[model samples]
Target chain A: MSQPSDIIQVSNPTQTSTKSALKGGYNPSLGPIQLPTSYQAQLASTASSKRNIYDHSLSRRAPEVNLSSLSYIFNVMIQYSQKNSKGIQELEGKLNTLGYSIGPKVLELITLREGKNAKREIKLVEILQFIHTQVWRTLFGRVADELEKSSEADDEYMITDKQPLMSEFISVPKDMGQLNVNAFVAGIIEGILDVCYFQASVSAHTVETPGCPNRTVFFIKFDRDVIERENLRFHK
Target chain B: MSKSLKTTGEDLWKNKADKVNSELFTLTYGSIVAQLVRDYKQDYTQVNLQLEKMGYDIGIRIIEEFLAKSQVGRCQSFKETSEILSKIAFKYFLNITPRVENFSTDGKQFSLILDENPLAEFVELPDDEKANKQLWYSNVLVGVLRGALEMVQLDVEVAFVGDVLRGDDATEIRLKLIKILKDEIPAGED
Candidate 1:
């Protein structure tokens, strides 16, 4: 973890004497940048620190958005994809591609908040749990319903999140055959998987679990190559 | 008095539960379009001509947030960014981070292993073959990332390396960081 560099204080030498009576207040340049108005006042109020502390304090007060907005956008995305698509498979493909595109950007944003304390996840299981909990919470406002190890393979796992936000109001028409309205969600999962540098296969499938209203399982199978690398990392 | 109070109640009910309300989407779309028109001196007709144009606009800003929040510094190579992308960025933002398992000796090539994919939760591929070809829903993602990264001056070729539709065991996106340009800080002094 790298410590943030010292905050660069740009003081005007000409005004240094005039401002000395003010007890070396905030450097004008260091004043809150063009943050959203909602956050500007909060940042300004907390901007009392003379140097690096003020910068860190401002960054801390930065606005964090709720998952509802993303959910609303995703709902429209589903409608848009449905309107534009020719059939079910094409929609799924489209959603997957969409998820792929957003994956890298999502990864970047999440890691930035972790700052220097963030560590690279070396173990396969640990990374999986991280995704099931942290990624799920950030995007969906709740951790996955369950995380299960594959009975058939040691390297495989299943993360289930019932009532995913994208699927909240969607009901796939039977006539559309096997089309899942939640393909967009699958795309997001695909994006996360790809960004995490997991060279594995992931597929979203509907499983009927008794008493569970929205039982959906994301079956993730790691490539043999991944297994080999995990082995090496474990031994090392 | 009863009728007037009833009308007010009805209005509140409608306001609170209007599912078909396009206001949020329209406002977001409108703001982006307006900005484009102002920035490029284009007409409103041209602005309405391309609403998807706004996706890229949002992508550029969103990507900057991702970079700042992730605090990913200059990587020695694109490959390193790939690893950081999977482990740190993916984990922090979306939570379902991938594990880099398969690495070609060249270090330029590797595979990301995903165990949990949140987006895929409750997802099922449509069974119709025709729908598969016509609906390229996921293509927007490729464009979003491409546009965002390009704006940041990281010219990289991104594509879905593999997919379950292709009968491959796993879905994979192959991102080849083609070039890292010299950091040209934006025109206005930072």
Candidate 2:
């Protein structure tokens, strides 16, 4: 049902090149004097630290943090971003950017853990389901409440979570108006989708109802290029 | 007394603490560091300073939860404070209690050595020399300690002396009390 064959060639080279580029020279694009973008260098600097993240088993440490601790750190992050932001959208943008960085890393590691069953997804619907079930479960401890496609537009889809974990402890001041912190989660979805060539713009929206005040729906709109490829491959 | 504290910490972790998978916590912290790296644009010092400041903000709020959960009484001395931190605070929250070690002659200073850091899991610093030498991947912990201690009226200085992640002999944090805030209640209690 999915063409896992050809995409491997495309994603394979950069995957290897990524780690080896560490110890390579700084990118000229970042201005001459800038400290080398540390994250790229951070990806695979060996020997500097006696222990790497790999030396320890993924399941070794207790895989849990108290909710209170998470809430405290998350709140602090929001406050820090808010102080630096121009307005609510910018604040949400920063959180989205912050969550975006975690997206790819989580996807890769989780895929690795999925082992032999994991296959590269080439179909739009398959990748969306993978995200709806696997990605959501791993990140938030449960499958999202629902995943539904838009009736109006073929390229638009929505994944709804009744009580999104990220914004549970957060109460946006009434004046801010409709800023869903789950934009961070949306950034995560976009991060995963972009890295895998699904090429979607994901945004978090507050769709509060009397029954579910914390309801958030992540809107995923595929890029023209991605939709074109899907039409060429599947529709034809 | 310390044994009781350990049991209390264990119970909080086992039952009272509402838990989430540490994977999200670890990755989120790592990404925050990466975002800080971009925001500061290769200025590792600013990234580190900002991380510590962020941690401090967390520490202030986190203390209320730590205190309310454990029923820990006012520490009789800085030595006792260090023990509770390693045994109880770290245990129930991050799930690793750094070994408290190398006490200064005055008893005002001490170091904590971490065997496993949950935050830095799967994290490797950039291959660049300056980034490796200058960056403290987990300086937020230092800020967290300072902020949390300050909330309890313990004015303190905390920094990463060494990190195993950096290929140091051990991952250690040095904490020194400047003085107890003598005036009245904690700063944020209003």
Candidate 3:
């Protein structure tokens, strides 16, 4: 990895330091003039107010964006991470961390916009249904193919997608052993669940099916405490 | 006639592709930009360069996808190339066809005025004076154009000359065709 200073040097041929720029003291011949605390505070407040004013009229709050651009950006992200990574799992971890950062923000925004009159989900099944229908539809343009509880384990649940959107354009090499890059999506799911006070572990696995190359099954296992509480709440 | 022509063009695109939910796309782009801001320490120029670099990498591969999906052959002329780019490539991928205008007399330079930029769908430049002046919010488009054209044997310089997010009159990108690269034959094949 290149050092921050090295990157800055390469990026800016003129060698302008951002710190100096932020301080409004970008000059080589003279020292920076110090501004008093009161003056600086006033400037900061004015800046924020100006931003609010600018944002007030222009830039619609619509969340829609072109998917092709998003896919290209995601491809770049995957390629960059792959360059730095040692193994498939580490790359998955990096992607998960990336998705985790986004999950909470998306969850909050979607939940707020979902229904004007509906309440926040309290039941386990209600939350899962929300994830299955509303969240999935909002994100992928379709509901997940199936949501099933594990017959063998009460704590385990699965959300299946016949063709996961994230991996639609991705083709894993044969040499890389069992790389499900959909772990990034899994991390997003985990992040949403965690934000809603559901402690869970989610992992994406490739499930081969006839004529479907990108079929993914996301297995979610809730924490023991969550299951116990659910049992008590629902009287299961 | 113009209305019918426009609807036909849109219908052709609508029939050709599946539409994914745009919220996911918007959030993903927001995350990418936010990550770049963190990585570059809010140095807008560095952020622009890094985005362009990433776009360049994506453009090379995406061009292959474009060629496979669309029935577009090698452009006979630069005029044809720009027409296909604005009318076909942009329409197919973004569902918005930018207008190509302000062509130089030599036909080697032009500006693409994007009335609807999906990348800047929710973008607003910070009110800070330095950032407002320095940030090219959609610099990636320039890199994408450059990389994709280079692969098709056109050496070009592409750049964002104006941005609406920065309080410009409109979003515009300028492109100057440097030269057309000749195909190199392999040593043994020739």
- Which is the leading candidate under DockQ? 2
Q: Output the lDDT of residue B108, model 1.
A: 52
* Sequence-dependent TM-score of model 2: 0.85
Residue A186, candidate 3: Cα error in Å is 1.4
Docking class of 3: acceptable
Where is model 1 more than 4 Å wrong at Cα?
Answer: A1-72, B1-47, B50-190
Name the regions of candidate 2 deviating beyond 4 angstroms.
A1-49, A58-62, B183-190
What would the per-residue lDDT of candidate 2 be over residues B14-77, giving only the tens digit for each residue? Answer: 8888888778888778877887888898899999999999998788878988898888899999
For B70-131, candidate 3 gives per-residue lDDT tens digits of 75788887887887788777777777788989999999999899988777665655546767
Q: How well does candidate 1 score on lDDT at residue B34?
A: 30
Docking class of 2: medium
Which portions of model 3 show Cα errors greater than 4 Å?
Answer: A1-70, A152-154, B1-11, B73-77, B125-131, B186-188
Q: Identify the leading candidate in terms of TM-score.
A: 2
Worst 10 residues of 3 chain A by lDDT: A18-27
Q: How does chain B score by TM in each prediction? A: 0.56, 0.95, 0.90
DockQ of every candidate structure: 0.02, 0.58, 0.36
lDDT of 3: 0.75
Better of 2 and 3 by DockQ: 2
